[model samples]
Target: MIRRMIRLYGTWSAEYGLIRTHVLIFCSILEKSHKSLIGLTHRVSMDPSARIYSRFNLHLYDIVVLVVSNAWAWRCSTTSTLLPFFHKNLGESAHLDVGVGTGYYPAKSVHPFSKTGNVTLVDLNEATLSTATSRLRHAGYKGTIDEVQHNVFQPLPESLRGRFDSVSLFYLLHCLPGRMEDKGPKVLANLADALRPDGVLYGATILGRGPGVSHNWFGRRLMGLYNKKGIFGNADDTLDELKRALEGCFEEVEVKLVGVVALFEARRPKMK
Candidate 1:
């Protein structure tokens, strides 16, 4: 355990160093480019690479800032939606959220049991971290919750292993395109790898007809034609895929569709 701790610490330090170096480079480019643009500021100037970089940075940064500044809102919804499950199972302990967007599930909200609850919010945005840190300190919650900005595409950090009593996955998954039947089973398998044996998972999504199906079946030929444009994942894909994902991971899973929205609940299988 001691060796693992040391290794993890070293890895974190190295990651931080890399992040700092990248930030410095980005800033240097922005500063030099902005200065050079002073003369052309009046023109509708654009750089495709710069625009893409700026947008990517902005998206990550917004998540960091928003998470910290918006803890309270998260608290309310979490308390109502997820707390009861935690209370019934682990009885008021810390929890972790994967792909926790802007600390919305754990911080600054009216958790009546707030004093005993600790939340760790994880994301992959530095701008998000900076903003969240400032917001947390300003709210006088300087160290109550833990924050991590890393990709969850691989195994979760060891520091978080077996630490959460309940885990929540909000409106995640289904961002990438896939046909309905194939998509759900694959993503659920991924989520299962990260889950605690006794933990509960909850989430929601929007649903509709499969992309492969004709849009004109309901007397809407124009709408069917438009579906081929392929912007968002079709509802059929999301619905069936989510169901399949839960089945392999959770011993028991339930789903409901309310109008256009679908809700899901799953639990990691308990040891026999």
Candidate 2:
């Protein structure tokens, strides 16, 4: 549908162009609504055993869609694609997901690791965490999971200090800006400090490619407004930009391009 709309707009103009723009905006909203409805429907349609331990039930299809959508956005591990890095990085084989929205990554991707390990889920949204807590239990995940209402912009708690073997930034970096060029570095520096010497930080985010596809001058101005309010920044940042920023604290960095999204794995320096 999204592609169809783009194609329809390509052949039209003037009045039709104006109408198409509105249609595109409306469709974007509808797309989000549809995904949420699908997610809810999937949860309710699950078999009894599937919902046994969790409050909300999720069917296999829901996880599949979430994983694929994230992969499109350049933030996931699609089966037969990326190896299970979480299993390789953690000492206790522990994983930490920062800004974990509704536990989507863990619910959809972490199951592969759960057979032999545990994950620590952290997010600032209490409601989201509540939902995650229920879902993890429902899945009967064997790993020791921790759900915390902690803000990533601030220093993490001492109890969690130097604790994670691998941490996932997911798509959260693009969500914060205004001083992204500064704040991004500071945030990663803090994350680097929190990781054990041999630990790894895995992340994916959109990169900057000017303002193509987005509206226009007014659209750019609107984005600037969003930047001021800290709602969004560069939806995507270049690999070199992110690497140069991360190099200050991390010893080694590896990056891969997955469409418009950039995936990164940076390791903390070993102790002398």
Candidate 3:
């Protein structure tokens, strides 16, 4: 047991450096005694590449971690449930996925959308976009697939404005930089602009404050430390804040907190 723990620590340190590793360990211990202390130590800014998702590759181990691990089950559940909802409402309309990593949801739920319409996959990471495109192709997706390397923080191409009937930002907002109050609404507005009038917009985000925040001690510690390291920027993004952001951009917004995730579906009002 001690050897396994040592190996895990070594791996973490190798990836994130000794200082971060020590901080994580110290926070994990502090969480058991003074949980609030962990919250006080989070950093104000973080480099984009510091996030594990940026470094994550589509590999056998990553596949297993995404599919089989309970820690990631919330993400799978949110995508599985919401993607179908988006497809049912989309009906012969174009669809867009922002930050389509490894194309997991697209590969699994895109068949229905692809049968009658086209799909676009956008991401900042070229490698991730390439992997996602390949995965969709390998999954026998015969529909037109457009892969664009772009950052969601910036305005989308003029050609793409109001082009999609459905736009998904699943597991995306929390990974972005800056506080949710300032950044979340901006990102949502950008995505909302990409949707046609009355079009549906849906996505999920990992919340920083919620009922399930403390369910897993190790998970909480990891999240806290990751926030402190700037690997995640959702430390202040709660369920209420997410709802407010969505409501500000769309005519109707519905948000639900399932575990540590905030799942939402909204729609732009039809042009008068």
**Superposed Cα deviation of residue 71, candidate 2 (Å):** 7.0
Instruction: Note the Cα lDDT for every prediction shown.
Output: 0.48, 0.58, 0.67
Ten consecutive residues with minimal summed lDDT in candidate 2? 46-55
- Each candidate's clash count: 15, 8, 0
Give all candidate RMSDs, comma-separated. Answer: 19.8, 9.6, 9.6
**How many angstroms is residue 117 displaced in model 2 relative to the true structure, after the best TM-score fit?**
4.9
Query: Cα RMSD for candidate 2?
Result: 9.6
Which pairs, if any, clash in model 3? none
TM-score of each: 0.52, 0.64, 0.73
Note the residue pairs that clash in candidate 2: 43-57, 54-138, 206-236, 206-237, 207-236, 207-237, 208-236, 208-237
**True-structure lDDT of candidate 1:** 0.48
- lDDT rank order: 3, 2, 1
Q: Is candidate 1 or candidate 3 better by TM-score?
A: 3
C-alpha RMSD between model 1 and the true structure: 19.8
